[model samples]
Every structure is written in structure tokens, then in C-alpha cells.
Target: MITRRGFMKVLGGGLVSAVALGSYAFGIEPLARLRVARYALTPPGWSPGLKLRLVALADVHACEPWMSARRIASICERANDLGGDVTVLLGDYASGMNLVTRYVHSSEWSKALATLRAPLGVHAIMGNHDWWEDRTAQKSGGGDTFGHRALAGVGIQVYGNRAVRLEKSGFPFWLAGLEDQLALLPGRKWKRAWMGGLDDLDGTLAQVTDEAPVILLAHEPDIFPKVPSRVALTLSGHTHGGQVRFAGHSPVVPSRFGDRYAYGHIVEGDRNLIVSGGLGCSIAPIRFGVPPEIVVVDLG
Candidate 1:
């Protein structure tokens, strides 16, 4: 029923659109685009008197030609300019993809991150890539990953299943960080029915001594369901907004919950979670609708 000329025109249009999309996803969005996503919320149980602004950066999978040290420093500069009361690094400082001209070393990336500044100081937590990329930590199954040491070396406090009490203008709150939930990879030497995780949500929450509202920093959003009402807000970055999202849906989320916690602000039963789209690629160098971002959360 179709004419040859009409069919050829349709095919040509399709090819052109595909080429444009490919260029934007693989080159423009991944390499050039950086955005600051701002969110303001007053979570239930949060003190009316206390106001906090948090700048969060995550998944800086640093590597050559993509996330170089220079690029990271630029990002840090922008983050510092935001004038947040606190800054949090949500992890995955190591290069996650193998298509790098050269791997940016921990020292290089950490040095760049050292430029980040906040009145309450910069705090960090490790992500799965930070754990899985370290051969020494992976083999031993229970030691500080290279990413952890590098962050510490730069004077950034890295929390591992720990809670810290912090105050802003005489209002106190608790900040808790859980270890990576996907620390150990499966291998012949160590076989497990379930992927090993180092996170201790129960133990970490137990450390919070008082009723001061708690803000939990988890690398992956998979821990959201278990998060109790005790936590005012949960911040995470690991799914990378499924790396290619459209119409508020990410088709291939890395999470066990599928698209439920794929990205952005999600509220459920008085509990709140904000997942960052993050700054770098994961398994592949591609980004589409979900461009790299630095998330700014304003909580009261």
C-alpha cells in the first residue's frame, strides 16, 4: 500500500533522527551538560526552627576524557558557590566504565574534591563502585576501600555505618551514612545466593542518640523502603536516573525495585527520599534526558 518514494522518505527521516539522538546522548549530554537541580521540602517531624541547605554530589566516576580532575574541580567550584550549610559526597569516585583513555587515580580526584567547602564541613559515603573497583578491599571482603582512604586523606569525613550529630545555627540534627549495599561481587571463591552488602541500616540508626531529626545518606535508593519515619529525609545516587530516562520513567533501573526509586523526590507514608541523577556515566558513556546534576536540597 506504500509508494517506494514515501517509504524512502520515512527511512531517511528515521535515520537522521537516530543519528541526532545518538550524538546528543553519547557526546553532548555525557560530556558537556551539567545542571543544578534544586529541591525544597519540609519533611514531617523536621523542626520549624531549623533550616538546612545541603549540596550533594554523587557518582563522579572519574576517568580520562570524561570526568577529568579539571572537570571535577570545576564542579566543586560551582558547588561551593551554592553556599550550602553542608555538602555531602554520595560516593562512586572511581571510574565505573572501562572505556577510559586513562583511569583518574583516587589521589587526583580526591585532590580536586578537596576544594569543596561548607560551614559544617564536607561529609562523604562510599558507593558500590568505590568498593568493587578496589581489588584489595574486594579480596579481603572487609577493609577500607581506596576511595575511603582517599576521601579521608583530603580531610573529608567518610561515614561507614555511623551517625554524626551536627548543628546549624543552634538547631541539631543527625546525619547517618550506610556502607555500600553492594560491596562484594560474586566469584568462584565466594558464592552467595544474594549479592553481599556491607550496609547496616539497623545498627547505623541505633547510633543516633537523640530525637533530633535524622537525615540518612545512602548510596543506593534500594534502602528507602526499610527507612523508618525516624529519618526525615534520605538522599541517594546510584541508578544515575537509569542513565537514559524519558517521560519521567527510566526503563533499565539498576535497583531491585525497578523504577520505583529511579530518580527525584519520592514521598511515601511520611518518609521522603531524594535521589540524584549524579555526575558521571556508569557501565557506558551515555546519557539522554537525565543529564548530570548536582542536587541541592533545602530542608526546614
Candidate 2:
């Protein structure tokens, strides 16, 4: 009784409607909760006895309702489930400190973050957004007001160009964190007189011990070349690893320029740099080919 052309039109319309709704709900509204791990890299010559897992979470702009307290809590629960040796928050904890009250005010995010307990210790380093002069007066590698206190309040050992050593089965390794390379502002000095130009990686390594494998953390992956040979593994989460890599190619990363240092694990000489695609959105909200990630590295 129905005309074939009319029926086809109706079917087409129905499919279009469904796609529209799905896009708005899933992509725009974030109607689905996604949990994924982009295991970065394992340290070469890793000790069989040492089992260190580092979870790197980065670049959660939280500029809009895309991220809420419930979402933050959900992310934390997911991180806890990963079960790692160290949980490292790479930075950009908030869109800005002012929104801290607009979104989560009760320290629930902090408390939920602390729930992520690690033996080697829960460590974090400042991100550019977290330590701007307008945000916090600290230079690169320094902790800002919201980022420093909130993470520390939750028992995360936030660092400013500092290192912490951990021993497993008598095998020692160092975790060194530097201030955000992107956070470098002109005319301000970093604390401890430690942070210098990107070329000063040799100087940075001077303070780090070569007696053991060194794991370096710099917010931007571009600074990979500056890192030293003693650093067997490095964890970074800036550029969001192109935030949307596609077609066997990533978006133009504003940070790293070299061929080997764009995204994922890069073996530069003796150093292995694992750049996490990272969690959360930044600058823009569209993520077509790239999904947010949690980087899990196995030390064993």
C-alpha cells in the first residue's frame, strides 16, 4: 500500500535522525563513559624483579560540563583499577583555578585522587595551565596554588625540578620531575636554580645519578632530546599526543618538531620516551580519531 520511494525516504530520514542523536549524545554530551589504556613503553634492560607501573594522566581542561565531579570520580576509579607502582598526574588539573568552585568545590576530586594509592608514591608535576603567572607565581617546575595544594592535599608528592629514588629488590631507580617546559615565562627564575634552557638536559642529568635507570617527566614531549642517556625511560603527556591522530599521521604537534618525537614511544639513542595521548580535552573539544588515554608502563 505504501509507495517504495516514500518508504525509502522515510528510512533515510530515520537513519539520519539516529546518527544526529548519537553524535550529539556520544560526542558532544559524552553520554558514554570510555576507559582505555595506551600502554606507552617498557624500560629496556628492565629488572625482572622490579615491577613499576606508572599511570600518566594529563590535560583535563574541564572548561565545560564535559567533565564534572562524577566524571572526575569515575576517572579516579578507573585509575585505581589499573593498579600501578606509581600514579603520576602530569598536569592541567583545571581549566583555571576560578572554575574550581564552579565545578568541584568539596575537595572530592582530591580525595578521590588520593584513593589511588601507590607504593613508590603518588607523584605529580606542574603543568603550564596550573602554574601561569596569572594563576600561580611559580616559574616552570614550580607548583601553583590550585595544582600544588590540591594534589598535595590528596597526598600526591608534587615536584618542582626534584627527584625521588625508589628501590625494588635492591635495584634502585630515580624518578625525576622538571617544571613544565611550556610553562617557562620570560623574566622569572625557577626555584632551586635547577631549570634552564631546553639544551640543558645534560645539566639536568648532572643532578640525576647514572648509577641506575632514570625515569624523566617533562610535560612536553618535545624536550625529549634534552634528556640524557642515563634516562632509560621518560614519561610525558603534553601535546595530548596530537589529541587527534589520524590516517597514520597526527595533527601538527605544536611542541615537538623532530621526526621521532611526535607521539607514542620513541627510542632516541638510548632513551625511550613514552608520550601519553592523555586524558581530557584541551583548546578544543573535538576528538575524532584520537581518544583520551591512560599510559601504563611495565617496569618488569
For model 2, the local distance difference test gives: 0.66
Q: For model 1, how does the per-residue alpha-carbon lDDT over 1-300 read when each residue is reduced to its tens digit?
A: 889999999999999999999999999999999999999999999988999999999999999888999999999999999989999999999999998899999999999999999999999999999988887787888779999999999999999999999999999999999999999988865554556899999999999998899999999999999999999999999999999999999999999999999999999999999999999998999999999999999998
Runs off by more than 4 Å, candidate 1: 190-194
Distance from true position, residue 235, model 2, in Å? 0.6
The numbered model that scores best in lDDT is 1
The sequence of per-residue lDDT tens digits that candidate 2 reaches over residues 1-300 is 879999999999999998986575337533244546556345666655666777777766553465666777677778878877778887776664342335544265566566666767778876776655333454334335576777787678977677777776688888888776756445434443343332245555667665777888887777776676667788787666665566746756757484345567777666788877666665655454556666778766
Where does candidate 2 have its weakest 10-residue lDDT segment?
Answer: 191-200
Q: What would the TM-scores of all predictions be? A: 0.98, 0.77
* Global Cα lDDT for candidate 1: 0.95
Clash number for each model: 0, 1
lDDT of each: 0.95, 0.66
